[model samples]
Every structure is written in structure tokens, then in C-alpha cells.
Target chain A: MIILNQSKLNPSNIQPSEITSREVFENRRHFLKAAGFGLAAGSALLLSKQSQAAIAPVTFKANSRQKISGFSKTAYGAGEKLTQYEDVTTYNNYYEFGTGKSDPAIQATLFKPRPWTISIEGQVKKAKTISIEDLLKLAPLEERIYRMRCVEAWSMVIPWVGLPLASLVKWAEPTGNAKYIEFISESDPQSMPGVRSPILDWPYTEGLRMDEATNPLTLLAVGLYGEYLPNQNGAPVRLVTPWKYGFKGGKAIVKIRFVEKMPLTTWYKAGPSEYGFYANVNPNVDHPRWTQSSEKPIGAGLFGGRIKTKMFNGYSEQVAHMYTGMDLNRNF
Target chain B: MKKQHIVFVKAAIWLFALLPLARLIWLGVNDNLGANPIEFIEHSTGTWALVFLLITLGMTPIRLLTGQVWQIQLRRVLGLFMFFYACLHIITYVWLDFVFMWDELLIDVAKHPRILVGFAAFLLAIPLAATSNSYMIKRLKTNWKKLHQAVYLIAILAVVHFWMLVKKDLTEPIYYAVVLIVLLGIRVYFKYKPLSKSKVIKAM
Candidate 1:
């Protein structure tokens, strides 16, 4: 067993300015230039290498389809560490690609996300099939770091760059009769092999109440981590409802329909007993197979540990009013 | 069977049975168990448990077909491995996954049918594992056969537990189900055939 000399490593002996000065060496160029003429060059190089390894810059492949700019530098929060871009893209549950967590990253490479069109129809005053470019021009995108909680009791903090869903809903000019907005995902069996199997009904569908759809927190994400969304992560565009479970965020959206009644969601239709239409992240309410009280954050290594799940995934302040007076247990 | 052959077979079975546990340790030490290691460990142990259960079930049919009584010795070894893996699976869930939060675990078991079924199957395997030794086998005699027959029921419950655990894509579960059905079918066919033949002979 190894024991540390606690007296020598005491925090009281460390000066605040010394700590701040040490942080200044975080810049590799500064460290290199300062050490260029000194005998401390070797140790400086070693320190720089160590720091560089700790904060290795993530590289995102550029997509020609992505054009939204001026939204990359925005930081949503400093508290929660963002789930690694690699994990965010590679570990996914986009069933259209495949059911395995890693399958989407592999199979979705063949998926054609560009030249995509989303048809806005059903009870909308302006019903049109718009190209992705035209949709991008509709509104300016902003980076929002949101906590995504999956029903499987895993969670991630993703920095998503997107326009608010409310802007798109407003542009559609829904008729007075529209009560719900249904989002449909692309599902060509030739492309999405997972669709061939009856794992879920083809053309995965998800819906939100009109009020929920127009909520400021609801985003139509086009990019993640200052880059175009990876094919595995819904590519060109996808829904991002921070308060609800991840499945509610329909991937690779193909169609948006304004309806007078609640739409049949894929998971809810598959197993209503397990997946309810309103999949709000409620810690008090447990899933049929697992408890929702806690979540293991992905990319947080083997024993990276778990945190207590919050109601509405810690967005209760923003979304709790939407379900006021309604029994969450019953809705769940 | 020759004493040497029995020793060789036992050594091979031991290595084969311990492979999954060894692989898990390697993966854990190498930090290659992926995002959710607890889940990975749980799933790996559970699957091995089911695989061993199926292998144990298959032994009887193979013995019947080949007229090898030595296969019966292998069956006990395989059954013990099945129980061992099942214990690991449960221990992983209780100690690592839930962190010994008994209240939450109890609530989860009560709420989830799959967890309840899996726990029940593990509970049933306890008696069989305990009586696998020669001492208990001789003590119980005919009743031991009846007690160990619960493995068939355990197999069904294990399959259902796996089926319910997955969110979608029943391909893996379906494969397990098919293997189990074939094994059970073979046992049923052999079991009734001798009875029917004896009945015909008695009638004549």
C-alpha cells in the first residue's frame, strides 16, 4: 500500500496566484515559447504534452450541407461536462440504422442525408415540401447545451446548435384546428435495414402537443458540438426536446404534420404499457423494466458513476407548467 | 469412461466454463468494457448463464443418442457453471448496478415483470445447485430428479427475461428461444417414445 505525505501536499501552502500562474501554462504555444531558451525545456515539453492529452481538441468532419454560422461559440452551461463528441456520435439508439448502440455509427454512414426535404402538411395554412437549405435560412441557429435522458436510464449533455422548433411551427402557420404536431422520420427499407425487421412500425413517428411543440426549449437541431450533426446522430435535422426522454426526439425528420388529435408514436404504439405518449423524464415515475431515479452518463468510464435523475431531467422549472394539474403518474 | 478421459474432460470443461469470467477480468483491467461496464458485465454473465443452461439441457439428449453415461458427469459440471454465472449476474446487478440499494431494488423487482422472472429463476436454481453433490443426490434419490427438473422452467424464465430486457430487435432472444425449443423438443420426443413402445408391447 502507498501512503501520501499529506503535510507536504497541503492546500494551505499553495498560493492562489501560483495556481493561476500554473493555469497560464495550459496554452501550449506560451509554454513552448517561454521554455525555448531555458534548461526547463524538457519538463515544459512534458507538461505541455500532458495538458494537450487532457484537452485534446475534438475533430468533426465538415459537411457540405451545413451552412448555419455564427452559432458555434455560444456556451450553454459550464457546470455539466459535455459528453465526448465521439460518444455522442458513436453510441446512439437510432433504430432506423440498427438496434445496437454502435450499429448506427456503422450503418448510418450509407444513409443519404443531403438533398433531403421535409414536408410540412396537415392543418397548416402553408403546406410545402421545403429543401434543407431553405429550412436553414428560416431562422438563425443557437448553441444550447441540453441534458438528454434516454428511457434506458442513460443520459448525456450535448451541445446542440439549432433553431427553436417554435420558429418552424410559427412559419408553418398552423390552422386553429391543429392540436398536435407529429414528426415522422425517414424510413426506406433499402437504406434503413433495421426498418426491414418489424422492430417498430416503419417511419418512426413522434408527436408533441401544439403548445409543447412551440415551447422555446424545443429545438430542431441541425448540428452538434460546433459541427454538422453526424449521420448517426440524425444528420441534417432532428428534434431536441430537452425535458422529455431521448426517443421523443425524432431523428432525420422527413415530415411534420399538424393534427387535431394526438398522433400515434412508434414506441408508445409498440408497448404502451412501457413507453407512454408523454415520455417526460420523471424520476418519481419508473419505466416498466427499469427505475428512472438515476442515470449512468455515457462516456463516463466503467466506474464513472451515476447521478440522481431529476424530474423533467432538471428542466422542471421550464416545462413543469405544461403538465400542471395533470397526474404525471397516470400520464407516465 | 476411463479415469484419464474423465480427468481430461473435467479439465476441458473447467477451462471452457471459466473463459467468460477470465475475458471479463481482462476487459475490466484493459478499460475495454465500453460505456456501461456494469451493464456489459451483467449482460455477459446473464448470457453465459443461459448458454450454460442450454448446454446442460443438451447433454442428456446427446447422452441418450450416443449411449454414453459419462455425459451425465458433464451435465452436473455444466449445471454448476450455469448456477455460478447466474450468481455472478445477480451479484453484478445488486452490488454494482444498484449499489446495494435494497429499497430501490425491491421496488424495481416489484415493478418490472422481467426482473421478477429473472429473480425467480435464480431462486429456483439455488436448490438444484445445492443438491448437485453426490451426498445430496444419494440422500434425495428419486426426489432429486424432480427437484432438478425445475431447470426446464428456469430456461423458459431466462429466455423471457432476456426478451423483455431488450427495447427492440428480438433477433438475439428469438435465437435463444429456437435453441431452447429444439432442446426441449428432443427431450420430449425421447421421453414419450419408450413409454409408447412399452405400452404397445404390453397391449400385445
Candidate 2:
């Protein structure tokens, strides 16, 4: 009884990669990438060794950099290369100043971010106005170096210095009816040129589900790179959600409201289909204009390759549970 | 124009065309290309390519309206410069930005209408570039004129390519699109105006 076709491996169909065990094949690719990076990093390590100093503060303006003391460090994103201090300060998306990447750095120089007060109102037990100083004292500052993936297919690894939004949430003590948290960014027509135009019905607003607001990864970042946040990089205070796209992290926030309904956000208003409430960094859900599959690392220099983007910007361990049983594609 | 004056104008155009690239190189050396040098390079090159396409398109319209044969003489040079900048732009995307990632590029083009149209514009420009020479022009004859018509499509594709990539702000792409419309509009008006009058004469 000769079998017409035996279950033998067809030599023609077998690829060189298929011949190796899955583990070995995967490891080989990893080893090659690591080898290349090792050679590239050799010079960087040598140069860094000579300094042995803290990474110098780089500001677009002369007096912009101010050190923020007493913030404890964390191992989060410790392995990732920090986007250059200059890039973090200069290249920003604070459309308040202007739409150009460098516009915020240049235009926000004289714009004031001090004497700020965040009004926590809506469905909270009691509405309270917390000043910048008072807000700083609520929780001890900590350094969380999270990978900030922008909605525009770009990313930066920022060492954000701030307290978690959970701290703010706990302080707010929302009512049972409070299902969502809304963030309102400053809309100073006098200072912010962008708000003057009918750009997204200004006084930019962002929102998150009550659960998302209290996530451990959700940060109320006040500073970055060991310095008080640069005016262009959301001075005084801003939201930094590692799992979500950068736009979800509103800048120069002035008000936070506890609402039963989801608040209309600036980006979602600007482009409904492109931007959504759950703007979680899901590589599977593609933004209509830009590909979400991979992102260009800002400080990776000119010839750097775009690294494949991860689910929840690689904070799945901490934040994936929050998005369980949800359709990211539709919500995105 | 005097031979010397014509030569001087050509040289001046050459200097002007090279300025953007020279400035980029200087900026790159000085580490002044800003935070995202790759983005800076990509955008700068793309802008220059669109600018040149308009400049090239403007030549025929200038010749038509002003009846200046000199602009016609300069047309080939301008067209070649447009193609040259376009080549540099695509090189930056393929080499520096995308890094020969064909699989990803294929998937990207499939997903994005902008990428596919932009690539189509670049592909169409290749034949125009190859046949711009005197030898090809002599061989193709009237076919040369037909082949060159793709420039109109290329210009449109290039504008759409730039237009679609913009997130919310379309102020820049609008300028390019408007210029293209005017340039193409003038050609349409000039081509049909005389024919309509001739038809009226026949009716009379």
C-alpha cells in the first residue's frame, strides 16, 4: 500500500529560517540586532564615561531650564535611550503657541505658566481649586521614564518627573455618578496664538474612563529630565499616559472635571474618525493618515530605523488589564 | 536676451536651485536640523520637490501669457531641476526614513492612499526624466509631447500626496494645489479660447 503523498517535509517548501528551532531563530535575529547596537553604543559609552556627569540641561531659551529637586527615580524605561534634552524641549505639539513643532519652543517663551490653579469640579463631592504649589505637595514626586508615543507616528522616551494621576484621583474623591475624568488645557488667546483661530473649539479638553484615570501608569507629570517642565513641554503641569498616545496627555491643564458622560476631546473634535476617546497605543488600530504599526524614535538620529510599535506602547503588563474585552479598533 | 545675459540667468537659476540643498547640508553639519533631523530632512526635501514642480509648470504659462520665448528656453532646465529634487526627496524616504523596508512599505502603501499616490507620482516622473534628452525627443517626435503630458498628472499627484499627509493644517498644501490649479487652468483657457471663436465664425 503505497501512499500517494507521504507526510514528509517538502525540501522546496522548507525555508532556511524554518529549518531552525523557533527559539533559536528568534534568538539569532535578536543577537544580530544587539550586536549592531553594541558596536554603535561602544563609542557612546566611551564618550559618556569621560563626563560621568548628569545629562546637561538643554533648553531652547537661555533661562528656561530649572532643576526640580527631590524626585525619586524608578527603573521604568531605564533600558531605553532618552530622547535628547534639546528635542524634548524644542520639538513639541502644544498647539497653543502654533502648529509647527518648533513653534511652541519659540512662542511659549513669554507665556506664563505660574500661579496656576486646577479647578476640580463637576460630580466631585466638593469642587476644589488646587494651586501648583499645593498640587506638588499632595504626593511625592517620582521619575517615571515612559515611552511617549505620539499619534503622529513618532515617539520619545521621556523621564517624566511627577506624581501619578491616581494620587489626584484619590484626592478628588469623585461621586458615584462620576464615570469619566475630563482635562481642560489652558486657552489663553493673549498668549496662545492657536486658540485665537477656531482650532478645535479651543480650551482643549481630554478625557479618560474612571478606571484609566486611576491606573498606576497614568501620571500627572510636572517636569521631565530632572528639571521643571519646559514651557514648551507642558510647563507647570500636564498629563502623561504611557499606554495612550501623547495627545491623550493634555498640556498646560487648567481644569479637571468629574463627569458621568465622556467629554469631547480636542483631537476627536478636530477629526472624529482619526482620534477617539480610547486613543490607547494599539498598533493593530491604524490611524487613517499615519501608520501605527511602527513609530520613528525622535532622538534615534537620521538613519535610525522605525521600531515596531507595541500594544499599549509596551505597558501591557500594567495597563492591558484596563483595556480587557474592549474593541480597540473601533474605540481607536 | 544676449548670450551672456542668458548664460548669467541660467547660472543664477542653478545657484538658486542648489541653495536649499546647500543650506540643508550646512545645517546637518552644524547639528541644526532640529530634534528630528530625519523628519526635518524629509519635509525640507519634499517641500523643495513641490516648489520645483510649480516652478517648472510656471514656465509654459509664462511663455503663453507673456509670449516670452526665453522662458521656453529655460523650461527644460527647470523641468530637470524639478525631477532632480523629486529624486532627492524619494531617496530620503527610501534610504533614510524607511531604510529599504520593502515589506513595510508595501503594507504602508496598501493601507495609505497618500503613499500609493505619492509613489505613483514618482514612478510616472521616471519616464519623463528618461525621455527629456534630445535623442529621445528626436526619436519619439509627437509621442514625446504625449509622454510629457504625464507631468500634469504628476503635478496633481504630487500635490495630492502632500495634501493628504497633512494632519489638520492644510494651509501649506493648499498653496501648492492652488498654484497647480492656476497653472493648469491657464493652459485650458489658452487651448480652448481660440477654438470657440473659430466655431462662432463657422456658425456665422
Candidate 3:
């Protein structure tokens, strides 16, 4: 189980982890009804390591980090290495934590991310639910510089470390009829404070078309900035798409389903006219009451001049071909 | 001599009113507003607009309660200044958030209910501003009072705009809401009290 050290120390250098398999954590729920069950369960492992005075560090070496061939860092710390809890957990996109830019940072600290698994099903030929560890072992982790464009016209550049969804889906073996892939976030209201908010439907959900999911641009991120994922940024698993609006990247993910038809998405379902399934960051397509032609980099202040938006967040060379001969204005 | 003195005083008040906005523009240019500039600009303009609005709403009450006729003359000026700040608030969102994309801008306003409420408040103020001149007031006559009644609705919406954006920090918005309710309460109490037109004009 993945337990967090609330202190500022690096997970790898922190005290020894009270490691427990998913099987025991999930099955022993009834046993945890007793008093002091948490300390009692973890103390058994803690006593075994007598030499470790403080605690052995929790090491999260998911996979080797490979650099993608051609991508530029964003203006706001895109390619910069993220310090474990400081960078990854501090910056967040959860609006329910409070709409303030720092709401997610303050509220997401309570998230319990251990003992999570992702269920992969739908139109896949070989469908099975895999623990986060199994999914991490499926593909090699690679560092890809992704420019995240929010629907609100603010942008961020993040170097995400994860496997391409195409490689992982290949393992699941998507059926020939599968036309779309939908990702569901873990809906535990007990830990995720945002789930209790009325602003967005609980247990946030997002989806991408089969082609978009398989596109080289899509990544199932396990970490960013050379460390394990932060709780604010989806922790153990989440989706990362370079060409689309940031909302397409579902956070705190737990389920991945392949379907023959387009799946209903949270933003689209909440307000279809405002948020479309194809929320690609196209400067040409304007939001109903705002222009999408430009964006202010996050932390640039509200009145800062906008940086001109690109055709596909400057990823036209890699993704523009998908909309060949079709007018982006119409699709947008 | 008194007329000349009045002109000078009016000019000075106009300059003083413009100063706060000038400082905001300068701060925006220098990027000194702090992290999350959008929030800073939005809050600054929204608060200034509310201040000017409350001041406009207070003109009659201030004049009646304190017998200051000069306060009535400042009403139009304050109302316009409120409109000015509202314009800045809208402009900041258009330039910074929407990047001047009319379609997306329209869609965003449509999608976000809070923005729609704010837009309604701003739009209602526009007609009141346009009809503020003596020529329109004299032309409309009885309709002038009806036309300006929109300000009450605008005031309520302005409060709603403040309330929605403040996710958790209710202190600032709630304070404004209470002040608005009190101001509206005074208007309501006086509204039912029987009075003569000359006495009302003298009080204002």
C-alpha cells in the first residue's frame, strides 16, 4: 500500500515504509474495526527493522524515465524537475478544494492514495483489473514535456513521466469495435474532499476517443518531475494528453474502460456548450464568452498579457494531421 | 464665484476618482499585483465597482439623513465612476481570460451562471449611465424614476457576483451583503413614510 509521509522529507529518504500488500489492506477492512488498528497492523513490519531508527524511505521507482524526441518546455516550469511533495502536491487543479489557485494544495493533503487499483474493461479483448503496481510494470516510464492549457485560458508546462496509453492498451488488447476509451477517477468521498462539492459531479470522469487514446500524444502518467505522482496531480495514476485542454487529463484515476461509442464526460455533461468532448486546445475555436486565441501563463497575474495560443497548443506537427481537411472551427 | 468654486471641486473629485484606476493600471503594467493576477485584477475592479455603487446608492440617504445637498450632485459622477469600474472589470476578463475571442467569450458567459449574473448587473448599469444626462432626465420625466429603478436590481446582482467568486472566504462578501441590505433597508423605510416633493428635494 502507498502511504505518504506528511513531513517534507523525500519519500525515498524518509523513514521506512509500513509496506502491506493490496490483498491484506483490502481484505482486512473488518479487522481494522478494533482500536489502534492502523499502528498495530503497521508495527509488525516496523519492529522487524530494528536497525532503522527513524524509518526506511518509501522508494517509488515506477519505470525508467525515457525522454520523448521533440517537445519544448512551457514557460512556467514545464521541464523542471519536481520535488516530491513540494512541487507535485503543491500545485493542483481541483476547483472544489476552493476556487483559489492554491485550494487544491491546502485541501488535497488529506487524500489517502494507497491500496488503489485500475479496472480496465469495455470493448477490450483481454480485459482485467490491475493493481497500480501491475500497471506501472506494463510499460517503461518516459519523460514528456507537455504544455497544459486550461479551459480558463491559463497554461502550464509540466514534464510528465508515464507510459503511452497505446502501449498499455496493447496489453489489454482493445477489440476491433472499440471506438473510445473512458477514464474514471476513484470516487471515494471519504478522502477526496472535492467529491463532496456541488460544482462538479462527484468522482470526476473524462474520456478520449479510441484514436486519441491510442495517439502517441496520450500518456497514462505515473509521475512527474522525476518523482512519484503528487496527491494533487492524481497521485498513483492519471491521464495526460498534450494536445487537449487540461481537463481531459483525469486525476486520481481508478478505472479505464474501452467503449464502442463516445462516453459521457463530466465537463460536457455539466455544460455541453461550454465543454466539448474534443476539448483540444485550438486557438481557432473560441469559448462561448471568451477568446481561446491566447492564454496567460499561470502565476503571470490576472492582468498579464496573453501568450498567443497555437493551432493545437503548438503541437500541430504531431496532432494537426488528425483533423486534416476538416474545419477546426466546426469541430470546436 | 460660488459656481467657479463648484466647478473646481467637481474637477478635483473627478481626478481623485480616476487615481485609483490609474494606480491599478500601473500596477498591472509592472506586474506587482502578486500571484494569480487574474484574481487580483478581478477583485480590485469588482470591489471598486461595488464601492462606487454603494456610494451612488447612498447619495439620497446621505443627503436626507445629513441634509447635505452637495451629496446629490455627486450621485451622477459616482454612478458613472461605478460604470467605469464595471467596464474595467469586464475588460480585464475579456483581455486576460478570453483573449478577446467574441464567440468563446459569449459561450463562457453563457456557461458560467455566475458570470452571467455579473454581466446582467453590468448591462443594467449601462442604460442607467446612458440616461444620466439632464436632457434624458427631462425628456423621460416620470419614466426617469422608473428607468433608474434598475439600479436596485444591479446592486443585488453585484452582491451575488461577489458572493459566488468567493469560494470559502465569506467574510468580505458577507460584509458587503450586509451593507447592501442595510442600505436597501433605509430606502424601504423612507419609501413608505409620507412626505412632500419640496421637502424631499430639499433633503436630497
Candidate 4:
């Protein structure tokens, strides 16, 4: 039979100095009942004192040297409730694992993200392949709570821990001719089962204009809610372009290439009429089959009500200038 | 059939027909509908609607092939259940999703072809559901058959709505489409073929 962790049940009484034997720990309640004390009192003793500690909200811990700096938590962070880490981790659209929203969480558990390497190549002056361990050391990670908007008209406020993508770009030293940056996700069918389906071209690809790639708001997230990124959320590393639709932030990234021309993104290649290359979160530009005027936050209760969608997902101040004269409807 | 047996069958039909809605309520009350409960509710109701529609359409073919007149008794129940689920699907969209905001809903219905098609299918189901009783069936006679035949068109529209709603996987809608085609094909074959004595007796 499986045993509940005793430490979790009695947080205060259990300590390193007094190591309880496994047999004693497992049979403590039986021993207590055998003794003169009433079972109710014995259970009360165990349950009362540490009840608060037992139910204390879990705080996620970051990796060593992964603590970020210079990120001031904004009003948006305070205004919007953070999506539960459980919900954020479990409900994902990582088609690499499978098409179902819950598929990634179950299927990606066996995925080995450690001993991973990401290649920075193409139009960069100094193209190099770096280990994930070394990649973590490249920049100080920061916690930025940003609104993630899906093209499917759902939204989530996520606390992401990562450094700016511009920092990585600077390290790569991109050539002036580099107009766009293409991101390639890990797509070996042996590792990612969803790749077996021809629903999308395998080895999912996404791209951003050089300026968008180098924008201050663009992040290369390795963690969420102050913890190491969950495998379903693209553990080790993933892209986070807050102003764009969530798909633009390709997960389980294995390659970042600086290109002279705009590369064909996977969604654009799959259905150009539905998914555009720019993919900026604009309320006015509806998807072919659905309206983008409003969104249902994932954890929001049934009929929890929708909030109106904003242009650039309410990051107009930061990203609107990038498309000063361009028509959002046309680009969308 | 014995009167008691018919009553027992009718009760069983009611219980079976109400199971999906009951399960939905249980899930809703227990908070077991997962993260996006609204989506779970919408998808469940919509899918059940399609299932009941398929079952209702299959009743005639099953009765004709098996010479089971009792199968016809369950048709009205299944047809009503389809309409009920379709109503729930629309209510969830209008009340929960759009919050009765007519302006936004109008714009949404105008812009999205899938929504328009789905709404059209639901609209078509309403008259059939209202006229399902013996009174209307007898009152309209042959015209009732003509009106109820709109179900074939509604089935196609429902399938198209499903096809348009999905993002990548076409497996589900394709499966539904195949079932609908086979059901329609059976009807077409029986309609066109010269009836043998055995065939006419079987259909009767």
C-alpha cells in the first residue's frame, strides 16, 4: 500500500534530529489506539497544531543562480489573479505532445529536458550551440506577469521567469542583414508522439521580425511562477512574446536562426487565411471561425464572464509603435 | 407488445435520454468539469446533441431492417433529446459566453460561419421538436414528413459546424460525416430500389 508522506501530515513535530523508523511512522496511529488514549484525541493531536502549515500554499523554488533582477512587478500583476500553477501546467496546447489540451502534461513527463542544447545559427556573426546549463547562466532571470492570449480567444495571466530574448540575441551577435528570427521546436517522433500525425508539419516552426525578437518585452522563459518550467510548458527553455498570440512562443525550442527574409511559420503554412505571420493580439481582427473581441480566462468559473480583448493584448504602449503605420486588420 | 412491457420500455427510454443532462449537472455541481468548465459544458451539450440527432435519424433504418416496430416508439424521445441538448448548447453560448449582449452576438453570428451554421441547425430542429407529437403528425399528414425531412439537411449543417469549429484534428467531424452518409445512403437505397415482397413486408 502507498503511504502518505508523514512530513506533510505533521510538519512541526517531524524533524531531522528525531528520525522516526518507517515501521513506527506507518503504524503510529495503531500504536496510539493500542495505548489508553482515545483515537479521536490521538487524531486531533496530529491534525490540530499543523493544520495551517499542512494547507499552506505551495511556493515554487527557482534553480540556483537563476534568480532574476530589475523586474518591478506591475499593476497588471496585482489586478489580475495568477493562474493556478496546477492549471497552468496541466492545461497546455503543446501540439508536439498531442492535440488535446491535457495531453502535453501526461505525455511530456518522460521527456528528458536535461543535457539539452540549443543551436543559434544562420545570419548571426557568432553562431554557437550552447548547453542548457550554460544557457541558464547567460542572463539573470526575472519574474514578469504577462497576459498570454491564445488565437483561440482564451487568455491567462502567467508569472514567467526568464531573461529578455534581446540579451540572447546580443550574445549571438546577429548580422545587420538578419530581418527575422525563426524558432524550431524539438520534433523527433520518438520523443514527441504528436509529431506522428501529419496535422501540422513536424518540427513546429515560428518566427518574429528582428525588431520583435530584439524587443525588451520579448522573453526566453525557462521557468514559471518562480519554479523551473514544467515539461508541458516547455521545460529548459521556451519563447515568450507577450504582445503576440501564444503560439508564437514556441515551446521546447531546439533552434533559433537569424534569417534575411521572413520565414514561413508552421501555423501560417498550415492555414494562412486563419493564422497570420504577424499574429499580434488585436481585438478587431477576428479569426476566420471565431471572434477575438473577448476571451474566457481558463480557471475562471463556468460563466465566470469574459473581459473585452485589447489591442496588442493591452501592451499597446510597449508594442504598438512597432506597427505605427501598418494596418492591423491587413497584417492580422 | 404487452401494455406493461411498453410502459417499462418507455420509462427506460426516458431514463436513457435524460442521462447526459443529469451527468452534466452532477459534474457541474461537483466541479469535475476540468479547468474550462464553460468549454466542457458547451462541448458536452453540442456533442450529445449530435449523438441524439444521429440516433433519431437511425431509428427508421433500424426499424426497416430489423422489422422492429418498437424502435419507432423511441424516435420521438431521441429527437426531443437532440432538441433539448441543442437548446442547452445555445443557452450556454448566449447566456454564459456572450452574456446576452445582443450587439456582440449579432456581430459574432454575422462574422463566424460556423456559429451561423450551428444556429441554423438549431433553428431547424425547433419546429421538428414542436411537431413531434401524434396530434401534429396526424394534423399535417404528408406535409409533416416533408418538414421532418429537413433533419437530413440539419445533420449536414451540424457536421459542417463541427468541421469548421475544430482547429487541426478532423478525425471526429469526419467520423460523424461518415455515419451521417451511411444513414442517408441506406434511406436513398431503399427509396430508389424496386421493392420485393419480403422487403415491403420487412419495412411494414
Per-residue lDDT for A75-171 in model 2, tens only?
7877777776667888998888888999998888777777689999999876999988878877777778899999888999888988889888888
DockQ of each: 0.55, 0.50, 0.22, 0.61
Candidate 1 residue pairs that clash = none
**Chain B TM-score by candidate, in order shown:** 0.93, 0.92, 0.88, 0.93
Ranking by DockQ: 4, 1, 2, 3
Model 3 Cα lDDT, one tens digit per residue, B48-73:
99988998898787755666666577
How close is every model to the real structure, measured as TM-score?
Answer: 0.84, 0.86, 0.64, 0.86
Q: On a 0 to 100 scale, what is the lDDT of residue A5 in model 2?
A: 18
The sequence of per-residue lDDT tens digits that candidate 3 reaches over residues A290-314 is: 4577776755445445678887888
Runs of candidate 2 exceeding 4 Å displacement = A1-63, B194-204
**Candidate 4 segments whose C-alpha is farther than 4 A from its true place:** A1-78, B197-204
Predict model 1's lDDT versus the native: 0.81
What interface RMSD do all candidates show, one decimal each? 1.7, 1.1, 5.6, 1.2
* Model 4 Cα lDDT, one tens digit per residue, B1-204: 677887888798789878988998999897677777888889989999999999999988886567777777778888888998999999999998888878778988999999999999998998999999999999999999999999999999999999999999899999999999999998887777776845775656
Residue B118, model 3: lDDT of 97
Q: Which ten residues in a row have the lowest lDDT in candidate 3 chain A?
A: A63-72
Clashes of each: 0, 0, 24, 1
DockQ of 4: 0.61
| Overall local distance difference test of candidate 4 | 0.80
lDDT of 1 at A272: 93
